[model samples]
Target: MTTNIDIIKSSGEKVKFSLKKLSASLRKSGADEQTINEIIEKVKEELYNGISTKEIYNRAFALLKKKGGYLASKYKLKKAIYELGPTGYPFERFISAILKYSGYDTQVGEIMQGECVRHEIDVVAEKNGETTLIECKFHTEQGRNCNVKIPLYIASRFKDVKAHWDSKQHETKLEAGWVVTNTRFTKDAIQYGNCIGLYLLSWDYPKDNGLRNRIDRLGLYPITVSTLLTNREKQFLLSRDVVLCRDLIDDLFFLDHLGISETRKSKIQNEIAMLCKH
Candidate 1:
């Protein structure tokens, strides 16, 4: 089995190789190959020995984003990944996975009522016939603040629930709402969520053990094997490396090939191992 460090080195090499190939192709097409090559070299020089392939791509994309025109494709791919999901599941997968793991049946990417317009709910989890609307936030460390979105989601859910109630004759209604994030929510966001009866679920790395332990205790199983595999397939298409992408694709095809359950823990271990191997 390949070690994590090896994987990282290999992936970095592949990124350099791919950039060289792309530069040469662009040169042949009469594009500004020299500038592209310089950009690639600059990015490579700045990259550390153990940087993951994704980080390298992000750096290149950021550089391209600063430039104009055709380079926009590179930036678009990065933006797509950031906005879509870590694994290309539309960011909503995080919300859906948490709900599923918590034993709630969920519908992802659905539109719900706001005050006057329809806004998309990342995930809607139903348990014992009560529905909880969820919104997912996948942001960087600086973007972890959830105060604005939290209040907006709560207000939207209130409108949606009220509309649903008005449409029906039944009196008993569903319970609360939820906002899930890949980063920790602000203290005020958490307190406000509680005040409005909206459950907040955040998932970061093990560094935030308090929150992680609490979520684990909740025993949420929102992500299914099928959903994970689907996400893997989508992400693979956006990958620049054929070999590493194929490896990930194959791994998804036979998830138990490493003899681990297809749960969040196993997936995290596999991803970490893969990144480290690079």
Candidate 2:
């Protein structure tokens, strides 16, 4: 029983709100149908023409938090990742960590020599004797998408690396060139990646292998998603390169470095323990 509600996106474009789309996202986060319906009904009541999607998202998230805290936090994963950086370097480290959890040996900010020029790779991951050169495209803004020209540029860099390696008699070979981003890719970017066989992992691209899917599969959420911490606290942790929830768990003393009270640190510790549980 939803109306034809149009909402404004972060990009300032207007589009009709789709309940089916909202429900699908909720379902992916493991929300029961009853809870999903309830959230939808509540969000519908607040909808209006030119309503921002962030407003809708916030309303739905608040309802979901009341219904299920974990699911609500999980829904915040992408935005939490947006909090990971004022730059892309931390995101490159974050991606390296994700790859490591998936059984790949990873290194960040590695410079690989090319025939014509030296290329610096954001991440270099190896698994089952295959190596992937990853170029991380990160966006601090929510609505920006990686475009076709990015892949075109990455493809050129991959050629230089390949050409450099081809001239050598080395044991390691290039398995793939990947452009991983915290946001989505444009239609042309996906098509270009498919046509060229270069890998692309954006927020929700490539079916079940997108960045979100991979993160969900492993439950390797970043520390930025914690409900126990404020936005300023999260940014402080990110500044120290403490991006993952597990990082705090591994070193509880890191919380003390934040100049917060012991009680707050304990709350954060408990929340991290719950959010990062297997």
Candidate 3:
């Protein structure tokens, strides 16, 4: 069998199937080495030229469910986030909730003045006098990277904000400028952010504090992860400002308001509770 096979990505581009990358993703989802190898073999056997990554992901997820349900659920996280929006607002709000859970008071879509210009920050996190200005880049499609230009543009904005506040008398103690995205960052983006002391958060970037790690740590799965909610249902919830799994836990009535059947509502609540359990 040929090792090279073209697979269509979510960005409508075709790329070579990567066994090592698949293994890495499974390992990150807490799969044991044996399971990872088994899944890889299964996926390799199923691969063909022009197969989509979505197809590969579904196959892997289904196999994971058979091997271990919890791992399968965990594996759904990145895709769940992608389901958060065609627009990034829902993602920003979701990130705000995560920060709030982590002890940072957060605000989404705050307008602030910089030294040189006015900037609309996505999420502002404040904890114990330390403030972090966050920019969220959300993509509904896979294989779309947060490229170097993003960090460059954001860094410039941060400098403006930092310089402005440093000259103000209101005692704003700014800690960092952060860029968080649901997708991966390009190599150049990571390198540029690190060189300038900018905080770059993306899916599986930093070993301990990547966006995925943070979500896992907080048990903050998005509402899109629930199998009870169909894609249209999830989109409806998103339209109504219901984004997080934790949101469902807090207000089961929200589900009821959406006209979800009582039986289905109970099932969804149980699923959300398990997935978002701290």
TM-score of each: 0.45, 0.91, 0.86
Which candidate has the highest TM-score of all?
2
10 residues in a row with least lDDT, candidate 2:
66-75
Q: Write the per-residue lDDT of candidate 2 for residues 1-278, one digit (tens) a residue.
A: 34577788887888889988889888876789999988888888887888898998888888877874467777788788998878888899899999999999999999999889998999999988788999999999988988899999999999899888888886678869999888888999999998998988988888888888887778788987787788888887778878788888879666787687988777777767767766
User: Cα deviation of 199 in candidate 1 (Å)?
Assistant: 1.3
Per-candidate count of clashing residue pairs (backbone under 3 Å): 19, 0, 0
Q: What is the lDDT of residue 134 in candidate 1?
A: 69
Q: After superposition, how far is residue 46 of candidate 1 from its true place, in Å?
A: 20
Off by over 4 Å in 1: 1-89, 113-115, 141-143, 169-172, 204-211, 214-234, 237-278
lDDT comparing candidate 2 with the true structure? 0.85
Model 3 CA lDDT for position 231: 87
List where candidate 3 sits over 4 angstroms from the true fold. Answer: 1-44, 63-71
Q: Give me the displacement of residue 181 in model 2, in angstroms.
A: 1.4
lDDT of 1 by residue, 39-81 (tens): 6677656655456655655666566545543333322322332
Candidate 1 vs. truth: CA RMSD?
A: 15.5
Report the error of model 1 at residue 191, Å: 2.4
Q: How many angstroms is residue 114 displaced in model 2 relative to the true structure, after the best TM-score fit?
A: 0.8
Cα lDDT of candidate 1 equals 0.49
